[model samples]
Target chain A: MGNIFRFIARYHLFLLFAVFQSVALVLTFSNRSYHRSWFWNTTQEGTATILEAYTAAEEYVHLRKTNRALAEENARLRGLVEDSKYIGTVKRGGRKDTLQQYTYTAAHVINISFHKRNNYITIDRGFLHGIKPGQGVICPTGVVGVVNQVSRHYSSVIPLLHSRTRLSGSMSKTKHFGSVIWQGGNHRRAQMLDVPRQANIQLGDWVVSDTRSAMFPSGLRIGKVAAFSLDPESQSYVVDVRLSVDFASLQMVYVIDNLLKKEQVRLEESSAQEPE
Target chain B: MRHPLSALLWSIVALFFQVFVLGNVQLFGYLNPYLYPIIFILWPLSWNRATGLIVAFLMGFTIDFFEHSGGLQASAATLLFMIRPWIVRAVAPRSEMESMPLTLQAMGQPKFLTYTGMSLLIFHLWLFWWEAFDFFELFSILFRSILSAGVATVLVYTIQLFSLKSE
Candidate 1:
C-alpha cells in the first residue's frame, strides 16, 4: 500500500497531464461535426456577445459598400415586379396565382472565418427570426452556405469554403449535375466532381444549384466553371468553379426559409428507412 | 520576481490578443500564427507545477472558447505546460532559473530560441495533427505544422523583442 502511494505521489503530474489531455482530445474529436454541442459554439452567450459587438463596430467601415449592394438588389427586385405586372396584363385567361416556394430573411453577418478547413459564419438572426438549421444562406451575388446551428439570437452557417460542405450543382446550359465540394486550402474556388466527360462542359459555363438540392432552391447561382480535367479512374470531369460570393467581404445575407422543407425531409427519411 | 497578479494580468492580455487579433490573421490559407503559447513559455520558473498546469488549461480553454475550435488549442497548450518544466531544466541550469523570466534578455538569445523553438514545435505539431486528424494527408499535415510553427516562432520573438525594447 505504501509503495503504491509513493508511486502515485511521484507521478501525480503525469497523471494530471493524462486526465487533462484526454478531456481536451475528447472535446476536439467530438465537436468536429456541425451538430456540436451549443455550449462550446460561438452562439454561447459570452462568445456570441463579444463577436456581435466586434462585428457591430466593424460594420461601420463597410456601411457604404453594404448600402450600395442593398440598393442594387432593390433595383433588380423592382425590375422583376414590373416584368411580372406586364405578364399579368398580357395574359388572356383568368389570373393564375403563383406559389411562393421560398422566403428570405435578411440577417447581419456577425462573424466569419474562411481560413479554416471547415469555415463557419455567424449571423445575428436566429430562432427568433424563424431561422432553422439546414436552411440555405445567400447574398446578392450567389449562394453562401447552409445554416448549421441556431441559438436564440444567432445562428452559425457552414459555408461552401468548408471542406465538408457538398452541394448539388448543375450546368446552366446543359443541366448536367455534379457535386460541388470545397477541397480545403482555397476560399475562392470549389470543385464540381462526378460530371460526365461527354456533357459538353465549357469554360466560363455558369453553375447553379440543382433541383435535387434540399438546402437551396433550384437555379440559385453558385459560380462559373474556371477549369476542368478528366479523372482517369472515374472517367469523369473534375471541374473547378470560381465562387461568386466574396466570402471575405460578406456582411449582409439572406437565410432561405423553405416552407415545405419539413414535408420533404419527412418523405426522404421515410423512403430511406425502408429495407432494400 | 513578478507578482502572481501581474502574471495573471499578462495572461489575460495575451488571451485577448490571441482571440481578437491573432486569430483573424491567417496567411496563405493554413498558416495561423499562434502566439498564445508564449504565456505558458514565460510562466514564472518558481511557480508551483500544479498551479502552472491549471493556468495553462484555463488559458487554452478561454482561447478555444473564443475561437470555437473545440479543444484543439487547449490540448496543445496543456501538453506544452506539462513538458515545460523538463524543457526549462534541459535548456538551462537549475541555479540560473531561480525566479528568472524566460526571455532572451535573461536566458541569452540562443538558449531562449532553442527553448521556444522546441516547445512551439511540439505545440504546433499536436495542434495541426489533431486539426487534420487524418494520416492519409501526412505530407500536408507536416507542411502545415512546420510552416505555422515557423511563423509563430518569429512572431513570438518579435513580440519579445518589442517588449524588451519598451522596458
Candidate 2:
C-alpha cells in the first residue's frame, strides 16, 4: 500500500493529465454537433451587423444598381420556374410529389466564423422570426449549410467549413449523389465521398443538393466539381468540390425551411413500424 | 530575495494585459495570442493545493466566460493549471524555485525557455487532443497545436522582450 501510494504521489501529474484529457474527450464527444454558446452569439451578430452597416454605408448609395441586379435575378428565377415546370432533369421525380415540401426565406448574414475546424455562421433571424434547426442555408450561388442550433433571437449554422457538416449532394448534370464534407484544410475546397466510380465527372461539372436531404430541396446549388478520382481499394470516386458560396464573403443567404419534412419523417417512421 | 508579491503582481499584470488587451488582437490572421496562462506558469512555488486549485479555476473560468465554449476552455485550462506545480517540480529543482517566481530572469535563459516550452507544449497538446475526443486526424491535430503554439510562443517572447526593454 505504501509503495503504491509513493508511486501515485510521485507520478500524480501524469495521472491528472490522463484523467483531465479523458474527461475533456468525453465532453467533446457528447457535444459533437456543437453547443450553441448563447453568450457570444448575440454579441458577435450584433457587433458584426453594426460593423457591416457602417462599412456598407458607401455601397448603399448605389441602390439603383443593386435594384437592377435583384430585378435580373428575380427574372432569371422566374425563367427557372417556368423551365422546370416543363423540362428538368428530374422529370418524373419532382412531379410525383403531391405538394411543396420546403420553402426558402432570405436573410442577410449577420456574422461568420471559419478558422476553427468546427465553424458556424449566424443569420439575422431566429425562432421568433420563424427560423428553425434543420433548415437549409444557402447563398444565391450555392449551399452554405443546414441550421444546427438556434437561440431565441438568433441561430448558428453549421457551415460547409466544418468537418462534421456533411450534405447529400450530387452532380448537376449526371445527378450522382455523394456526401459533401469540409476537409478541414481550406474553406473553398470541400470533399465529396462515396460517389460511384462509374460516374464520368468533369472539372467544372456543377454539384447540387440531392433529393435525399430533407432540408434542402432537390437540385439546390452546391459547388463546381474541382477534382475526382477512383479509390483503387474501395473502387469509389472521391470528388473535390469548389464551394460556390465563399463563406469568407457571405453577405446574405436564404434559409430553406422544409415545413412538411417532420410530417414526412413521422409518416415514414410509423410505416416502418408495421411489426415486420 | 526580492519581494515575492511584486513578482506575483507581474503575474496579475500578465493576466490583465493578456485577457483585456493582447487577447483582443488577432495577428497573423487566425492566431490570437493568450498569455494568461503565464499566471499559472509563474505561481509562487510555496502555495498550497487549495489556493492553487482556486486560483487556477478562477483564471480558467474567467477566460472560458469570454470564449463561450460552455465550460470546456475553463475545464481544460483549470486542469492544466492545477498540475503546474508538479510540472515545475518535475522539470526544475525546488531550491531554484524556492522564493522566486518562474520567469526567464529568475531561472536564467537555458532553464527558462526549456521549462516554458515543455509546459506550453503539454498544455496545448492536451488542449487540441481533448478537443476532438479522438485522433480523427492525429497528424493534423498535432500539426495545428504545434503551429499555433509556435506562433503563440514567439508572440509571448516578443512581448516579454519588449516589456523588459521598456522596464
**Could you give the fnat of all candidates in order?**
0.53, 0.07
Candidate 1 off by > 4 Å:
A1-7, A32-43, A79-91, A94-97, B89-100
Per-model DockQ? 0.58, 0.20
Best by DockQ: 1
Enumerate residue pairs that collide in model 1.
Answer: none
Q: Is the docking of candidate 2 incorrect, acceptable, medium or high quality?
A: incorrect
User: Could you give candidate 1's per-residue lDDT for residues A1-276 as a string of tens digits?
Assistant: 999999989998788878888888888777646335555444366688989899888899999999998998888778767455555365588866787778999999988888766677888888899998889999988899888878778888889987568899999999988999987676888999999887899999999996576777888789999999999999999999999888888999999988887888889999999999
Compare the candidates by lDDT and give the number of the best one.
1
The 10-residue segment of model 2 chain A with minimum total lDDT is A30-39
- How accurate locally is residue B15 in candidate 1, as Cα lDDT from 0 to 100? 86
> What's the C-alpha lDDT at position A56 in model 1?
89
